[model samples]
Target chain A: MEILNRTKKEGDRTLLDDLAQKELSRRKFLRFSGMAGASALVISGVGLTGCVRDDDGSGTDGVNLGSGDIGILNYAYALEQLEAAFYTQVMATPYSGMNALEGEYLKDIRDHEIAHREFFKAALGTSAIQGLDVDFSSINFSSRDSVLATAKAFEDLGVAAYNGAGKLLVSADYLTLAGKIVSVEARHAALIRDLISNGSFADLASLAPLGANTANALDGALNPPQVLAIASTYVRNRIIANNLPTS
Target chain B: MNVHNLLHEIENVDPEVYDRLDSRRKVMKRFSFIGKTLALAAVPSALGSMFNKAYGQTNDDVKDVLLFAYLLENLEAEFYKGVVGTFAAIGVPAGPAQGALTVIRDHEVAHVAFLKTVLNSLGVTPPVYTAASFDFTGGNGSRMGPFAAAASNYGVMLAVAQTFEDTGVRAYKGQAPRLINNNDVLTAALQIHAVEARHASHIRQMRRNLASGSLVPAGVTLQPWITLAQSGIDTGNAGANAAIQMSYAGEEVVSQATVPITNIGGAVISANEASEAFDEPLTKAQVTAIVDPFVV
Candidate 1:
């Protein structure tokens, strides 16, 4: 129900509104029932009906990440594509005053991002979404500050995305695979942070925006919609992740 | 299969079951209007799943994973405690390096406490381990292993710290699959996992800075991320320390999910980049082997 309202607020009124309408009708049916003990049964029946309804025909007109495990995979593939492209551009036009070591490490990062993108692409095979169109006009590639800031943003976002999506995966193998990739992203985030300002790699005070590293010292985790909203800044494609598993 | 009977059975086992199910009363209020329209045959399975959702999460598998995590956090907390306590003796000046070590020590301590609270909430007693319980030298309390100088040398201390942090990342990853049924715990564990990776990266940066005599080095290949199974630390005598090397084992893998990462889509992704792009998991057994040398 919270997600229903969120999607509605985002102006995605097609499939979500239909589902909400169905739920309203179901509630009306329940209200008209005379038997007192059968409300629980009706509620349970509504749940089953909702699960069945989620099987098909709810995708948006955009790049719809399908349902279930494949949807989760495509979601990851899309993020990797964005990151890979960003790094490829960063390497293609190195920022001014970037020292020799910075250039070398940036190239290494570029290659790593490329490797991650290709791995996801090959792993996804026919199910992979098409290459995304990025709008990097806001980023000043010639300026080291701007490029590093954006890199930090993407790395942190990637870590949060994977952390939030791990539980959505039904297969343990996929969860482990995601786990394997996310740590690398975190490592990248730390390096980028340090390159910007020393010893701020895991600084709890500065991590509030990303939403973790509090008193508990845990990293951030962002759900699909929250992540897509942030990622949509640079990605031109309207990534429709409405069908990703909620639980 | 009556809903009331199920509640009664649960109440018999957990006297405060309704309190645990905070919304049970709201759900019960809806019972008055459902009978005429709903089929009787559809009641039990849905209620069963709902109850399972409410209660079936903290099973033995989740407990095992949590317990393993607890042990690892205890180890890390103890190691950092040693480093922070001996920073002055170890040549760590009272500056950014010392400050960073203190921050890491605090985080590890918080992790230990957090895991303890979670385990206790699940009705399990977390085992206690303190600084006395660990030997940072990998000497099993004898303090004579290859890293014996770790307590006195800043570089050795940073190397040992990097190894533990890297191992922590891998250990958390390996146990994630066992926690799949418990989403909150899984997400929490991943949060901790990423923090450990950050710690590793910072330690690597410290080591690189130390080696190059520059806060930001020039023409140095030592990266925050591990490159192709390289320990990036001096393990002594041509890197003969098997205990330290074991932490990096299987990290050179260029294949994921049976797909070779090199030359993918005709991109010239070197094996080094392929391996660096992803960190591999270490099973509980492998992690135990890596940590046993330091545990008494």
Candidate 2:
């Protein structure tokens, strides 16, 4: 099949376009967007630009997550999808006698996750993956114990994913921004854990095991493969091999 | 709208195109010599400037730091395990403090296990052992070992434990950035690091409650932000150089020191010396020098 000879349009718009195009790589991309860049993902494909076509009973067609920054955007997109799904489920069927405070807290979590998901969608633009169909078969959302347990798991896992990936970011600015987000994730983990067990929150994970800890083992924590596996259930779109750093 | 369509779209696309695009981007990103030099020059200072930034050691030069982190996690896990076991065995006195300490100990074990898994997945063999010598319950370096019974000086021991826990929080924060590319590892480590910070805060609060007055015990340094000044005395004289006296949140908080987690206890600490409550990373030379005595 012949590749389309897409013509480059030139004008004052082209100057902005050229600069925007230059900001497609991981480090350079964040340099251009700062914290806001998370919302400006550019999609690459044949026909679909950034529009999320409201298809009849079907997701929009897939877009190419171009190399580097595009790949990172998709990675984030996948995570946001997972988080948004989990939180949405949590809000849908809260545990028995779940207080007004708990209700508000869970709602806040759902909102944060939606924001993160939407940010990736906007940032990836035409390149972003369409909405994923997540499987929640394993979770008994009706039970408070089950929901809280899952939330704890996700909150902890999200924090860990961020921690492991922060060093992988080539951009200092992006790294800084990720740090802020990870800390928030960690706070979420702590709060959720505390809600379940109260004073037992800090100790339940680290101190009971052994050694003079002498190192931080708290906050949210997870490595990549672990996180990917946990998140895999929600992301239906296959991640294209984009030559982003994995190790 | 649905999973099947998303998969079908993915299937229709050529994976090779993604590969080609990715490689092209990487080739473009590869350094102009000027860019390479500038990045290298900026790295050390940028990483060093903040605790969180310090973990952003992503380049090839950071293998040592990564290895050090692995070793540190191992050492910490072992320490907490020993404490929990000892407390359980005695079946002596149990209270809220002991209960909290026990939970923290369990978390440490999980952390150690988690980090080990990360290293294993990475195909990196972590340092097998650390010198298991610390005077946590005060007898000498080797006196109590990791699981020695809580002594009459439980307060002092708790203070030291709290200090070490706080230091861990800072050290992990310092190491976060370097793992950004490895989303899996970064995520796991961040989870544990946040837990450590909470542990530190709890311990610090306990110490404050115990003493009632603003005075902390000798050889104990609360995080820099928590002052001993209310008790009518300056606890330390490191001046600007103090480990716990750095500015955080626009205030001179307790300096969250970022020493290599492993080396801080086994090598740099003298049995009698106050555990230097500051972020002092031993240079490779210093680490080698201190570890030489214990290494076979």
Q: Of the candidates shown, which would achieve the greatest TM-score relative to the real structure?
A: 1
Regions of model 2 farther than 4 Å from truth: A1-60, A63-66, A84-93, A99-141, A163-168, A190-247, B1-100, B106-170, B178-296
Model 1, B115-178: lDDT tens per residue? 8889999999977787777777787788786678787877777778888999999999999987
TM-score of chain B of 1: 0.77
Point out where model 1 deviates above 4 Å: A1-60, B1-58, B212-220, B237-240
> What pairs collide in candidate 1?
A36-B32, A38-B34, A38-B35, A39-B34
Give candidate 2's whole-model lDDT.
0.47
Model 2 lDDT per residue over B1-296, tens place? 23234223432432222222222222223312223435434434422233122223333323554576565555556656565566645332378667777777776766766666666666676666643643343334555432133333454445445545644554555565555445545555655666665565466545555654323645654431122221112233332112222212111212211212112213222211111112222233433332222223
> TM-scores across all candidates?
0.78, 0.47
